[model samples]
Target: MAQLSDDCFAFGGPMMSVDDAVGLIAARVSAVQERESISLHEADGRILANDIAAPLPLPPFTNSAVDGYAVRGSDLPLQAEAVFPVTGRVQAGGSAQAPLQAGHAMRIFTGAPMPVGADTVFMQEDVRLDGNGRVVVPAGLRPGANVRPAGEDVAAGHPALKAGQRLRPQDVALLAAFGLPHVDVRRRIRVAVFSTGNELVSPGDRRGDAQLFDSNRFMLGALLARLGCEVSDLGIIGDDRAALAGSLEQVGRSHDLILTSGGVSTGEEDHVKAAVERAGTLVLWRMAIKPGRPVAMGIIGGTPLVGLPGNPVASFVTFVHVVRPTVLALSGAAQEPLLPMPLRAAFTYKKKIARREYVRVNLRQAPDGVLEATKFPREGAGLLSSLVDTDGLVELGEEVTRVELGQTVGFLSYASLM
Candidate 1:
């Protein structure tokens, strides 16, 4: 569990920008200290707990890079092709056995160790065998052209993988190359997810006349799972403030975070704000952003809680900006900000100044081979299909009031968001 102080996220100011909110979280939130050792196969997506230093140089020794002949740099031809007698032969997994005699070339295959006196290599394709069985070499070939020196890739005792890195497949490969069968990684964060409001019902449950099946809980669970979280589905709580507060307090004891959607706004029916205030500290922030404006952040029983909007699209967008970073910070993972891809705007749009907006867009290649972004036709934060049909979001900065056609805009692909 995260041992956070009650006033960890205390901000009493007016509406803040998206960058300000994220910066606050990065500055305040602390990572969980619990860690465990796991096999290399289970290390992907887990946060590394320690830096791994290379025990030996990569490649470990000087060796041939191709099926070629190894010779002394002094023996290399000065201007014309030179012929030298083949002194010895070496293949991959074979030793040099003896040094190459001066003016002689050694027939060495790829990965074969270089002989004591050899400092240059000539690819077999670049050289031919003379009628007298000597190896023919071309002129102007640079010395050390095909030679890979020791510690060329990574030196011994240098940092290969740093602490706080979220291990990917390639990172796992590096661990294997270092002959490590297991690694130490931070434990997966435990999140308790639930939705508020009486109008929501669990999917597959008998629905009431005015109730709709809950979708945000499942979506949040899936997003948390992608971040390697252990999610606990707490089901939907009703509009009653007492019951909601009780549940939040109880669940906060065991989980690292409590995430809920709906009831975050200031409506009379909205109870999450009051419930969290009753349970612990609550900082209701009015983020200066579209789709997700009313974001409730609080701490309960030493655990952090984030109350997102009821609308699916708003919840999704805020999750990307809010919960995602909080999770990364808690797991002690490195801060990897998502960079937007630039594309030409194929449609015109307008927005208010000083508020960042993410417009759903479909991307396609124009006849000229440049990527163009077309906005989704519908306009509503409640439209789930708008998120489904679009490829990604076109981010409009706080200062830009309008976007003209053919203008270049930054695009955030859905595939890269997680």
Candidate 2:
């Protein structure tokens, strides 16, 4: 395992920017521990070990792109009719080992190898065959028509995939094209997840006075599982400090990363921050962003720890913004995909002038072919329904004083990870 410095948790803050917080969390961190290889079928979300290059050309031979007949470029006369004998047949997977000879045409099917010396292919619909086995081609037909040359799809010795890439299903197909049944991949990162709150209950349990079911665990586990983490659910801990500390210590022992919700703020029951600090150190306290201001980071033993807000929406946003990247770093995956494209604002909304805001909005395509975004009705950080109903987020710039109805603004998709 790559060892990280114990000094990473020295920095504490009032409210830090997202980038600064990430840098602080990863300051002493190194790459995840490497693992042995497994079969491709079992390596769905694992990271790649090395760059893969093509051993040979994808097709490895010149073949017909369509169901057509092969012919020489100069075989047919422009004005006069020219007829040539069909010497051999070439269907899909047929042999054309010898070079094609002049004055002879070959019958070629789709995906069939091009005959030696044959440079053109005339479609069956364009030609008519007489009583004798011969083909008559029309004028204006070019050489190498409807033919796929060798190495056109993928050249031999070309780089197929780079290192640190997370393999998708399409990537599996790409590897399959190279005839590799098993590809080298990194092992899954172990993660332990839990929640802490006296007012929280399990889904099936009966609700007491003002108690809410624990959604943070489900959300965190789902997100971690999607990233291919080996998640260990530690269940829920109440307001007791000792219980929370015990659970954190037990989970931190065998996991690379530990994450929990609640008890990270200044409340009487807030123990996540103190426990993590006692276990190792607390790196950051909060961020300048709206809707999720109570985000925190620390280390437990040698594993990374993150304490999220008690509000369900805040917890989810913090997990997506903070914990997701940490898991990505540990998994050795490539940089994430592109962020949401910008869209013009279609409505007006009120906000404080200083803090950054991400408003949930629904998108619509106007008649002018422009995609305009409109804000949702409710915009509370505690309302999970607001996050559910809206299609994506409309990011208001910190420098902008106010937004006009028709002015353009940056839009962020709810699905964006980068």
Candidate 3:
């Protein structure tokens, strides 16, 4: 593991905007230097550590794009249908016996390498076969039609994949096409996640009258897993400053990031603020965002720590805005911003100005065939059903204060949150 500076994230400000908070994380954090080579089967979702250049052109040679009749461009009929003897045949994984003779055609299948002298092809459906084993050629067939040229997809020595790229399934297929069996990727980020509150207990534990089961820890674990992090579940901790401080210091030694939900607010029982201060440094960020206002960021023993709100909905929202970017930075992955889809609103809503808000909503196509968003009936941050029942969230900007029915709004789907 690579160590970060103790005061790397030491900055303070009053009520930061969502964009400002994310920008600060991107600017300050650095990626871990350790990298390892893994097989292509295990490369998906991993960050590429080095650039990969194409060793040879895709397809490797000029081939037929369709199962058709291959012929030289010069032999194409000028104004009337002509006939040519089918003297040769070629199928995928096979080659023509010799270069195509003038005024003759070769029966070729898709993916079959074209004969040296042939530069055009006529689809088998378009051309008919005569009674005497000759193919009827059509007039006005353009040169180089229905034939794929070498290097058409990717040229040799060109970049096939760049460093810091998060490899998707398609990206893996591309690497396989280039005959690469293994790839160098950055190691998964190690993250320590836990929940803090005296009134909380693990799901399997017997619950007391005043205690509830911990859900934030499980939710955060799933979110971190989606980001390809090696999660260390620290379970729930009681509201004691000494115990919290000791836990933070111990986890900070091995983990890249320490994350907790609850006990971050300025309430009487909120011990996270003081506990983090004792371990290292703490910067309480009053984010200008609804339902997720109090977010704590600190550095403990050269590792970063983030404390989020207690509400399940708030934890989910802030994770997308704050923790996602931090994980990407630590992995040296390219930052891909989430672009919201535009849709019409089916309900009226209002929010305070200067604070960004996300409203849970279900999307449906209106009678007229346009997609519209309907806000969830309940607005409580503690309701987990709001996230599960809705399709996604309707993001209201910091400047917009009111939304009218049928107005244009930005919709972000739950699938894209990661």
Note the clash tally of each candidate.
0, 3, 0
Pick by lDDT: 1 or 3, better one = 3
Q: What lDDT is obtained when candidate 2 is compared to the true structure?
A: 0.77
Over 4 Å off in model 2, which ranges?
A: 24-27, 76-82, 97-99, 350-354
Steric clash pairs (candidate 1): none
Regions of candidate 3 where Cα sits further than 4 Å from its true position: none
> How do the candidates rank by TM-score, highest first?
3, 1, 2
Location of the lowest summed lDDT over 10 successive residues in candidate 1: 6-15
Model 3 per-residue lDDT tens digits across residues 358-398: 99999999999999999999998999999999999999999
Which has the higher TM-score value, candidate number 1 or candidate number 2?
Answer: 1
Better of 1 and 2 by lDDT: 1
Model 1 misplaced stretches (Cα beyond 4 Å): 130-133
TM-scores, each model vs. reference = 0.94, 0.92, 0.97
